[model samples]
Structures are given as structure tokens and as C-alpha cells.
Target: MSENGAALLDEVEAFHRRFNVFPLEAAYVAVALWDAHAHLVDAFDSTPRIAFLSPEPGSGKSRALEVMETLVPNRMMAANATANAMFRAVSATETRPTILFDEVDAIFGPLAGGDEQLRAFINAGHRRGASTWRCVGDGSSQTPTEFPSFCAVAMAGLGSLPDTILTRSVIVRMRRRAPNEVIEPWRKRLNEPEGHALRDRLAKWAASVREQVDGAFPEMPEGVSDRPADVWEPLLAVADAAGGHWPARARVACVELVKAAKQSDKASIGIKLLTDLRLIFNGAERMPTAHILVSLNSLDDSPWADIGGKPLDARALAKRLGEYVTADNDPIKARNIKTGDGVVKGYYASDLHDAWTRYCPPLPESPLLPLPPLPRRSDPVDR
Candidate 1:
């Protein structure tokens, strides 16, 4: 059974390689294991959502999910669906559905409307026995109903996900295929049937060892723990069961990819601001507000340049910095800087030191602490 598992996984990996180009080698392994995990997802206490996200279009994010659609059990690819419709779909089938959610940015983006229920639904769905409580029946006679939320989910989208979803997800930051890269074209008529055949074989292999997988707790590689541990456990278990080079390869991918995620983090705007200021400061004790504004607005790659459609001004920057406090328990605000022209408002290195040390300090070569994000734009920017 173990050897068979390895061979089948190899086939699945090959199938994916032929059609879609994943961002990294680990991404291929992760997605293959994710596909296999979907068949026996009931055995695990939680399901890690896999997100293929890229900054721009034509990055093969959708193609990756499309490949998985053929391989997972009861695969349902949805680009748009209401929370009510989704929870119902989850419970409607006898077999748990493997949701291949494409164009997820459309539903989860900042501009999206009436999606709080859906976000909550996806967040709650991470753990087993999780359910969404809803009212069924007419207004006065409404009965509380539980809709089961646990299911395997793979998402493809244009941008990063909110941290609520990120902590529970295996994020694959995809890149556009370089001109030198080329692969076989995928046609539904020919390729879908091949993928479906592989799915059937994977399902059989999974059924044979469901009990073993259910009881097994695969060991984590050094430095992988907490939510990262939870996310990779089942995939490691699948690798351990396969009894081949896969176990070693799986651990290698786990460590490198987890490390990659930490270095690539862009989740918090506040942290972004802190880190950017650190760069702009460059060992200076203080900078005039005018100089600071020029540096901030000059940053073409970061959001500070065009936050809310205008270059971040002194007042707005001050407001955001106010969210973090110094050791004295007061907002870190700018004080007078003695410039050659006149006295002008500016921030001191002494005042910002506390916020920098607490929020986005310089670090050693290890995993980064998960930084809390700042309040959203719903809070009045002017205030």
C-alpha cells in the first residue's frame, strides 16, 4: 500500500507538471498531497485551505485549481456563490465536496459587498466539527440550524488573502511563467478524463488506509509548529505512509516553503510602514516632515505612495503611527525638529525606537513572528 501510494502520488505530480507550472518545487508536492488528502479528509481534524495567489493575471492560478478539480472527490469549482448557497452545497452531498474556488478575489476583495458571512464561513470551516448556525423557516418560527463547514478547499486568486484566511492556508505565491518556460496545452476534452482516472485510483488507495492515517501523527520538521504544524500534518502523514523518497522530500519542502512564507509576508500595512520608515531612516536620529513625505511618496513599490488614492501625508502617517505606542504608553507622535529654515514637526529616532522594536525589529535568520495588522480603512482616515 505504501509503495502504491508513492507511485500514485508520482503520477498525480506528473499530471500536474504536464499542465500547470507551480511557483516552486514544494508547491507541486503540496498540491499533490492536498489532492490525495481530499479523498480521506474525514480522517483529519482539520483541513488546510490551499491558496494559489499571484499579483497579476495569467499566472496559472486558475489553471492549478482547474487541475485539482479533476482529482479531488466531488469536486465543485465555484468562482462566485453566496454563503447560503455554499453551506448548503457542503451538506447537500453524501461525499464531502472538494471546493476549487477560482477568482476568489472577486468575493473577498476590499471592494466586495455583502461577503462577511462568506469570510466567516471559510474561517470556521478550517477545523472539523465546525458549522455555521443559521435560521431556518419563517420570521417568528425560525429554528436554529447547523450547517457543517469542514471540507477541503483550494483557492486561486489575484492577490493576497486576509490574515484570517492566511493562517489556515497553504499559500502558493505563483509567478507568471517566463518566456523560456513552456508546457503542453490543456484541453478539457482530452485532459479532464485523464485527471479523473487518476482521481479514482487515488480514492481507492486512500480508502485502504483511512484508519492508519486517522490514527497517525506525523512528526514535524524542526521549527515547524503551531498553525504551520497543523497545516502540514496530514501531508506529512501521507508522505510517511508512502514509504519512499517522498518522506524526506516532504520534510525538505515543509521547512523551505514555511521559511519562504515568513520572508515573503506583506500582510500588515502597519508593519509595512514601520519597516519602510526603518529603511528611510538609515541610522538618522530624526528627519523633517517634508523630507519624510518625499521619501514615502517616492516609494513606488509600496502602498504608502498611494494609500486611499493619495500620497500618504504627514497627518495620515501620524495617525497610523499613533496606533503603536512608546514604552511610556503614549502615542508615538512627531515633535519639533530644529531645521535651518525654522522649527518643523518631525519624528525622533528615540520615539520610534519602541514601536520599531515591538512591531518590526531587525531579526536574525529565523521564522518571523506573526505581526498583527492595523485597523482597516473603515476607520476615518482623516480622523
Candidate 2:
């Protein structure tokens, strides 16, 4: 590494010291931010995408994005942005700015009707790039202009984004600071020359490394999925170019964080709802709810079990169903299973296709059995 590179590492250490960020976490961020700055040198090329996420609010995601805004290039900060606006800014013909989004979880909430589409766009945008059109307004007619892909994306939000987006992003999992771990005032840097000097120096050093920041990602392990590869590839390239603790650090970060992402999507409860339960439903066609319990309880040993927490029990499973199919209009309902039956019982597959469309991904093959119609009772017949 060059003397300048060594100094850059030192400055990053100082930045962490000044800000009270954990040393290792700060290194990950510093390396990533530097990689991003370097990528900006050829902003026309692919840009890196990152997201700062947490399980709940007040985890310092926004503050971290703010610090990054001061350290990056061609920066744009949006607290709550529409999908169109986000795409336009990233792929603008005249100027493609690196994006920093705060409170982004609200914009992509599960209940928010627009979130799915926006998530899809973001997944594609951070990838090789998103292709969108801008209309040129003219007196006589309008012409459509195609904008290039996004540069880099940094977003802060509650919990993880869709797995697809997560796979493409360098995820920083922030936790709420303990009462004892207080950060210095980043806003007061105006009065602290050292803070300002450090930020400036880091930016300059990052700019110097711009030429070396290519988009070569290391091969992910077999267990690891390809979701975040596009976003993390550039940053890994930057780390390899730096060649020290950084390359190893980058890989470690990816492995650990990727595992976290996988775990985040795993269902916590034991009860199977939607298509997941539907599969078990098909496996034991027409069994009493009691027999179904034996099948689901056995799934603890299956790939679908043991999500974030331990495998959910039968009662927890019922609770999950209650949350989903609670409205009066819904046909499925969860009631206490008679202990005699040895399982919790409820109707199956009332809206299996709908749940699959909304929550689960598309299946690899056709369901094992065609969905059966709900059994209707026959009127009493002469004996």
C-alpha cells in the first residue's frame, strides 16, 4: 500500500475515534465509503449500493448516513423519496448523483401500496443498473430520453429491506446505542477544526484511490446467495486494491452480514400459513388438523424451520395465522385445537395463491397437488 493509503486508514481510525463508532464497524464503513468515492471517479461505470438498517427506530441510521454524506461525492440526500424521483436522480443524463435516503423504511413499508414496485426498481437500479426514460417537453411534441443506471445508493431504515435489495447492498446493521455509549456531536464540527480537517483529508484520499476502484467481487461461498453481489462487488474490488486487512475485512463483513440477512427473512413462528403451510398441507392431503400438527412439528428438522429465533411451536403458529387472516371477510380462522386431536386446526388454502403472490416467492415447480376446493357439507339424507 502507498503512504497515502496508510494515512487514509489512520484517518479513518481517527474518524471512528472521534465519532464513538466501534472500530471494526467503522473500518467496514470507511472502506466502503472510500470504495464508493473511488467508484465516483468513473461514475459512468457501475456504482456501489449500501443500506444502513436496524430492527427498530433510533439506531443511528440517519446519523450515520449524514456522516457519509459529508464524505462521499456527487451526493444527494432524501429522507422520504418517491421511486420515480430516486430513479431520476441516480440516472440523470446531466448529473447522476449518489443517493442517501433516510427513514426509507416508511417509504417501503409492507402496507404501503407503492413499496413493492419501488423495491423492485431499487433491486434492479442497484444492479447492473436501471433503465428509465425522461420525457423532454416541447411545444409541439414530447421526446423520451433514456437515463443510465444508478451510481451508488445508501439508505437507512428500520429492519432489512427485501432480500433482493439486501443482496445488492453493503448492509450496516446498527443497534441502539446503550446509555453509556454516547457519540460526540457531529454537527458541532464547525467549531472543531480537527473534525473538519479529518473529513476533508478522507475525501481527498478517497478521490486519489478512485482510479483503482474496479467492480470485481470475490466469489461467494456456496451457501451464500447472489442477492447483494452486485452492490458489494465494487466495494470488494476497492478492498482488494487496498490489499491489507481491508480485503480480508471486506470478505468477513460480507459473510457475516449476508448470514444476518438470511436469518432476517426466516419465519420465527411455528405455524405455517400461506404457501409454506400449503406445502405441508399437500404432503398430507385431507388429514385432520391433528395429523397436520405432527407434520408441521416435524419441520423443525427441515430447511424452513429455525428462522430468527427457534422453531415456532403450534400455538405461535396459530398466532401468526390470526395476524394474517383476521378480517371478517377472510374465510380461514384459527381456533384452539382440541387437545384430543394432537394439533391446532384451521381451514387451509382459502387464499393460498394470494399469500404466495404477496409474501412467498414464485415456486420452482408446480405444487405437488392441485388446490382442492373447500369441502362443502351435504344436507342430511334418508338413512
Candidate 3:
């Protein structure tokens, strides 16, 4: 704990500042700690993905990873890579590789049709000892094989990542540099060596404190708990190890950046369905399955009415709602309603109560301002 400074971290931050224009100072600090953390990832239970995302192109997202490339161990720069190749690369050696995946949106975006295998790999890889079992060899002789997926990954891409991965990431929202804020044009040959020098220094510093950082519990800032806590613990440890301004700075950065991320987070379809169901249920204690479908399909803003040129069917409605579990850990299901004719499937408001409370914020009240008195009618006009 030096009184002077987090010298190495400051240097790393400066290095990033040279090329990329991050939207916030906290992002710069986070990225610097992330660079150092990558070298010591083995000491932690989970490694947070450093995601550089933007809504449009030329936002320097890839350049951010490019600068990061020189500061991490066994850096593997990949774009549009297959799941098999990536998993093989991760398990190639005794040491985990720092994968800097550029253009990752391709794997998750709509045009690519989604790669579930790769998404699963990225998600599982956040935690240590996460392995994917595959059938090796050929034909009848093939045997199940285990592949380790845990590694440090930095991703740069346009658009948002899936919520699962986004939760595991320390997101740095990159944007096009303003005209007045200038940065050095990055040329790998010349600038890379300096970054490598810093990288070497960071690795040495990390090695010295690997034992201390392992299983260390760094106190989190307020409102930081659960998954966010897990994601910041490693980076905070690295900052605490550096001492000086970092410990305080890191906490501030963690709180602010995390606050920003949560505020901007996109609600998942499961949460959305829970909200819509609450609105559709209205005041009734129960509603028939067919009644629910009609209400869901009638919403003009929702896609249910024209799903594949047909209204949402009962099966799809059930499937979508089934994605969530109740507070009692039961899958949400429509119970049977006994009518004059026979038993028919229907949903009970009580069944959805827990889900609505947990998933949706309090429903906003309508202002109901007095309609402006109908504009006084203008005495039926001059005609």
C-alpha cells in the first residue's frame, strides 16, 4: 500500500486514453484495472468480460480491444470465429488465454441467426472449472470429452450483448470521439512496445499479489451485491493491491458505472411477459386461457397479433410464460378451470402475483388531468 499512487494502474489508464475515447473517467479506470486483472485471472473464481459496445460503427470499439491486446497474456484476437475453434483455443495450454473478440455482435445479432453454442461458451467461461462435454473421436467409438471454457475475454462490438453475458461484463460504452478531444493515431509497431512494457509490469505486479488476491473479499460499494458484486470483486482486489488513490477511485467507478449499466439495461422477454400478463390480468382473479390470448393479441404495440402472419396461439403463450419460475421455485403454469361444460386451462391472478411483484416496478398511476374543457367549441364557428 504505497501512499504515492497506483502507478501501474495510472500508466495503464494513460495508455488506453492515448487511443480510445471512453464516455466516462470511470470507464478508463475500469479498463485499466481490467487489463491488470486479466494477468491475474487465475486467482479469482470468476473473470468479468470487458465489453466495449456502441450503437454505431467507427466508435473505436475494436481499437479499444486493439490497445488492450498488448497489455494482456496470450492475447488471441478473434472476429467471427467459430465456437469449436474458440473452445479449443481456450483449452490449448495450461494457462488461460486472454481472448479479445472483435465484432462479437455478429454471433448474437439478429442477422446471424444467433449462435447458442457460442453464447453458452461465453457464459460458462466466466466462472472457474466450467467445462463443456463433447463427443470426441468418431462413430461408435466416440467418447464424451471435457473442454474447459474459463478464460479472460474482452469484447468489442456494435449493439448490446445478450443480458446473460452483459451481466457478467464490465461494460464501457464507447462513442465517436468529439472533434476537440484528440488522441494519438495508434500504430501497433511503435506504440505496441510501450504497451507491452506496461503489460510486463502489470503481470509482475499481479504475480506478486496472486496469493493475497485469491479468495480475497473486497468490500463493495453501496447497492452493489449479487452478480454485480461478483463482477467487481476481482477488479477491486487488484485496485486495493495497488493502493493509494485506486481503492477509493475504484469504488466510485464501480458504483457509477454499475448504476449506469443497470439504469440502461434492457428488460428480458421473460420480464416483459410478466409485465404484460399483469396488465392483461386486470382485476379478475381468474381468466380463461382463450381470454388471455385474445387480450395479448389485441395489443397494437405488441408483436403477438402478427406473429408469423397469425395470432399468438395458446401453446406459444404457455411456452413464453413457462420461461419464469415462481418464488416457490415452481414453473409458471395455467391451472385448470372447471366450467359448466368441462375443465379448461386458465390462469389465476394469485398464481401470477409473486411474479408481478418481483419482476415489474410499481405500475404508474394515470394523471387523468381534466381534458382541457373541450376547447369551448368556439360558438359553432362563423359558418
Q: Candidate 2: which stretches are off by over 4 Å?
A: 1-3, 20-48, 92-95, 115-117, 138-140, 188-211, 215-225, 266-383
In model 1, what lDDT does residue 49 have? 91
Runs in model 3 with CA error above 4 Å?
1-5, 265-267, 273-318, 326-330, 333-348, 361-383
**2 or 3, which is superior by lDDT?**
3
lDDT for each residue of candidate 3 in 1-383, tens digit (9 for 90 to 100): 42222888888898999898999999999999999999888899999998998889999998999899999998999888888888888886576689999998887764568889999999999999999888889789999888899999999988888889999999988889889989999998999999999888888888888888989999999889999998999999999988989999999999998988865624255666667778898878988999888888888766678755788889888888787667787888889998888999998887788889887767878745675444457656445
Residue-level lDDT of model 1, residues 1-383, one tens digit each, is 34388888999999999988887899899889899989988888888899999999999998898889999999887778778988998976477788888989898765555388888888888888899989999979999999998988889988777777887888899889998788889899999999999999998989887888996899999989998899899888888877678898889988887877766646567888888888899789999878998998898778877775788999999998898887788898989999888899999887888888976847558867798677697865655
* Candidate models: Cα lDDT each: 0.86, 0.57, 0.86
Which parts of model 1 have CA positions greater than 4 angstroms off?
Answer: 1-3, 110-114, 280-294, 314-361, 364-383
- After TM-score superposition, the amount by which residue 125's alpha carbon in candidate 2 deviates from its true location, in angstroms, is 2.3
- Residue 377 miss distance in model 3 (angstroms): 16
**What range of 10 consecutive residues in model 2 has the weakest lDDT sum?**
264-273
> lDDT (0-100) at residue 166 of candidate 1?
81
Worst 10 residues of 1 by lDDT: 107-116
What's the lDDT of the predicted structure labeled candidate 2?
Answer: 0.57
Model 3 TM-score?
Answer: 0.81
Winner on TM-score between 2 and 3 is 3
lDDT of 1: 0.86
